[model samples]
Target: MPSSDAPSIRPRRLRSTPAMRRLVAETRLHPAELVLPLFVREGIDAPRELQAMPGVRQHTVDSLRRISAEAAAAGLGGVMLFGVPAVRDARGSGIDDPDGILNVATRAVQQEVGDALVVQTDLCLDEFTDHGHCGVLAGDGSVDNDATLERYRSAAVAQADAGAAMLGLSGMMDGQVAAVRDALDAAGHADTAILAYAAKYASAFYGPFREAVDSQLTGDRRSYQQDPANRREGLREAELDLAEGADVLMVKPAMSYLDVLADVAATSPVPVWAYQVSGEAAMIEAASANGWIDREAAIHESLISIRRAGADAILSYFALEVAERLR
Candidate 1:
């Protein structure tokens, strides 16, 4: 397709072969850049597979320990824990309970892997509140942002006490990062870091996650989660989190928000993370099961694209599997 007036430049030369492609690669995905997101539940003796998220399980305490060990041995960068409590309440008291599922899992994983992997826990109430909202309701039943910050503060301390190296503030309440950070520092957990879910959008892509976590929401999360239509708003959220002393900023539903992720990555002072949420993982798994796509190649390309989008780290369900392949 070259024209008679074409210059000497041949762009394809650098991509002509696998070796050349490797040599010119601008982005790389290493096992150490992947963080596995895990779910732990109370009163379960064996790991139960999440039907919506094939190949992903809600683990029991002992099983979670084994999985954490596997993550460390496989060289994953970290594990993010989400708890499934046996009971839920308006205040999400379980989140502050030292023996809560998430806290217990955090301690177990920290003990199991030691410094081999960074242990993180979801510092949110959605998974613990009976209403499945991130925070308590106001008098009129809307999300009470300030009240949520208080809960997050206590939750941060609990997670840190249970040995979480980092707490993921996913609630999206204003001032949450500052609340939790101040709480951690005052509780003598100065080394405990915070990963603010700065650009989390309320997307349809979280359908599978609702199943995985047994979320009890009767309505949508549009009240708190960012609207998908806002790009600059995402950047504003990141700026606010950074100002609040967040150690890392994260963009949720990575594939759909790569632009936001890239923007945050370019502007943020700390590490930027992206989450390949449950629906993304389930889509790949479902398509591969039907022979519609090459499973391994698709996952590699998806993750590579996220990394190329400027994620310093990725939290995904495929972390362990992809890590083994990378090794």
Candidate 2:
């Protein structure tokens, strides 16, 4: 062991007190760095609570407006809207219709919150498709990548026209970012940004999300989404999206993939985001309800850890609650 005169460097000095910790904090999370993902189902006259996601609900257009207003008041970074259409067709016609539930909800939220909060919409067909796939299926029963790109192009333009400030490209289809970006620019919506779910993995964590959207997906997303065991592939996906003009790159199921999030953040040329998806939120809520853990503290700790791991922004189910607390 060392000589007493050797400079005693104690790292705990910064951890001694709350004020000291705050003063020396390496990473901090703020309300502006969090985006709330909201679900609005068509034909619902009132908010319907999701059984799987205890505190979350499928809201009506009016309820969406009210919630969006609260988000703006809480100073949230943005709101990502998912629509549960009452009807689904082979071509996902609802996705491109100006009167589509998602488009309608986007216009309502924009009118309610204006520029105070960024109003974003989920630019995907899974919720509107009869097959429950993110894209069109080929004659061979495989997902037709090219056809899906065409659908995404139309969806992006429609969302822009409906007042979406940002488009969340959640479908893991190849060339999606480039296709949607081109469509937006061609339609003179160059200012509309794309949040690419660049490294989304095929995991069971999406179960609750499927339930929330009333998805009828019969098969796994392994054919499109990345493999859970591959880290290098995740980086490659992120790199490709950035090169394709994605304004933000995201990794899904944030808690289980903090390593991937950190890797993406370290090398990404743009902002890196993490989605704390439905299953992750459900697990915490279920455990807390059973008195297994302190819900509030656990939630804060989980979010803080994600922020410390290099997430510039987070799409969390707890966004509203956390923002309210912070405010």
Candidate No. with top lDDT: 1
The C-alpha lDDT values of all candidates are: 0.93, 0.93
Query: What TM-score fits each model?
Result: 0.97, 0.96
Off by over 4 Å in 1: 1-7
Worst-scoring 10-residue span by lDDT in model 1: 106-115
In the order shown, the candidates' Cα RMSDs to the true structure are 1.6, 2.0
lDDT digits (tens) for residues 155-269 of candidate 2: 9999999999999999999999999999999999999999999999998888888878999788877999889999989999999999899999999879899999999999988
Candidate 2 worst ten-residue window by lDDT: 5-14
Model 2, C-alpha of 326: deviation from truth (Å): 1.3
What is the C-alpha lDDT profile of model 1 across 1-327, one tens digit per residue?
Answer: 988899888899899999999999999999899999999999889999989999999999999999999999999999999999999998899999998889888888898996899999998999999999999988898999998889898999999999999999999999999999899999999999999999999998999999878999989889899999999999999999999999999999899999999999988889999999989999999999999999999999999999999999999999999999888
Among residues 3 or more apart in sequence or in different chains, the pairs in candidate 2 whose N, CA or C atoms overlap within 3 Å are none
